[model samples]
Target: MWLPQPVHALPERLAQLIWGWALAWWRIVYLGAVVLVLVLSPSSYSRVGRHLLARRMYLDTLPILLGFTALAALLSLIITRIVVVTALSYGLSRYALEMVIRVLVLELIPLTAAMFVAMRCAIPSGAQLAQLRRSGRLVVLERTGADPVRMELLPRVVAAGFASVTLAALSCVVALAMAYFSVFGLGTAGLVSFTRMFGHVFSPEVTLVFVLKTVFFSLAIAVIPMTAGMYDLGASERRSELGGLARMFAVLLLIELVSLVGNYY
Candidate 1:
């Protein structure tokens, strides 16, 4: 007995999908490796190169840092208040600080920072790179003896990664301060207990996981959108943007899940 045509087509479609996904991941890894080499190489830091990197870093980081910190502070204040009030109502006030630290500082702030940078910097940079590629400017630069990847793309990636990490770090501090104030209300009476609780929550293993997760989040925000944009240059602008964002978010979600499992499970 012969199988239906639809059944055969389904397997072919599945294989195609798997192949495409694997190829996309391979390209992202390849690009990331190339960028890493360029970043570490001494020759990539000529005077002009240093200037480009510095300028991109400034553009990526300073302008948005204040706004992001304020947003993080507001969210931290609201969440800490809710957690403290709820914990007090349940007579579980002892756990409120721990919960606040774990939820806001460990999980939410890094993810938020990554997304914010992706939107503000990564996605647009990727789109610009894609346009340059599509318009053959990259080839023109290559013919002129300029390494387009080194001179154009590398700084953007580095700046974006730095921005994500910086934003997360700053926001984490803000969140912790907010958590303290919300729980203790402008007094030093809780200082010792707060430090003890903070230390307890950030054990070596947990601390390692948190650091790794934030780093991975920064990497994803830095790399994924650019990879998607560069490789999907044939697609329409809106579609490319959406696709890049979708892939970035998917990687971020996977990273978050892994971190959650490592931290809690």
Candidate 2:
């Protein structure tokens, strides 16, 4: 007797799922190799590469990163005030500094910075790269003996990584200052106490985790969209662009979830 349709399809579906995961893993490995080659090649630091890097840094990264960092600072100031006021109202005023440090510096600021770069920079850059690839421009450049990965992709990824770290660091400083001011006002009276609290909260272990989390956030913001753009199954530029963004954001969220689990649990 012939099997039922559902049973007949089950093996095929399982095979398809397994194949998809294999392809995904292969893409990740290829992306990692591309990044490693770009970073390790001495030719990547040539004058032309330096010019490209500067252009990406000044034109593409700095302006938007600064504007977003400022916006994050304002939002952080508001949040700091709220946290401080709530802690005071709850008779948990002693924990206010620690709460601000944990929430703002250790978590929110880096995530916000990564998301900002992803939305404003990474997706658009990936879309443009996909469009160029769809138009065969990258292949044309390759035919000229120029590595498009080095010439075209490296600067953008490097700039994005730098922007992520810069924005996160600056926003953390702003948030810390705001937290201090919000809790203790402008007087010098609480300076010693604030220093003590900051030191206590940023023990070596917590500091190490914060550094690693920021590094991972920057790498994710820089690398994921480019990888998706290069590897997604879509042929059309429009479809590739959308697919890249979807995959990039999904990866970012997964990284964030992992960070949360590691930090809290």
> Can you write out model 1's per-residue Cα lDDT over 11-124, one digit (the tens) per residue?
899997798668767877998898889889999899999999999999999999999999999999999999999999999999998999999999999999999999999989
Whole-model alpha-carbon lDDT for candidate 2: 0.79
Candidate 1 least-lDDT 10 residues: 231-240
Q: In model 2, where do residues sit more than 4 Å from their true spots?
A: 1-10, 232-246
The lDDT per prediction is 0.90, 0.79
Quote each prediction's TM-score: 0.92, 0.89
Clashing pairs in 1: none
Give the best candidate by lDDT.
Answer: 1
lDDT of candidate model 1 versus the reference = 0.90
Off by over 4 Å in 1: 1-12, 232-241
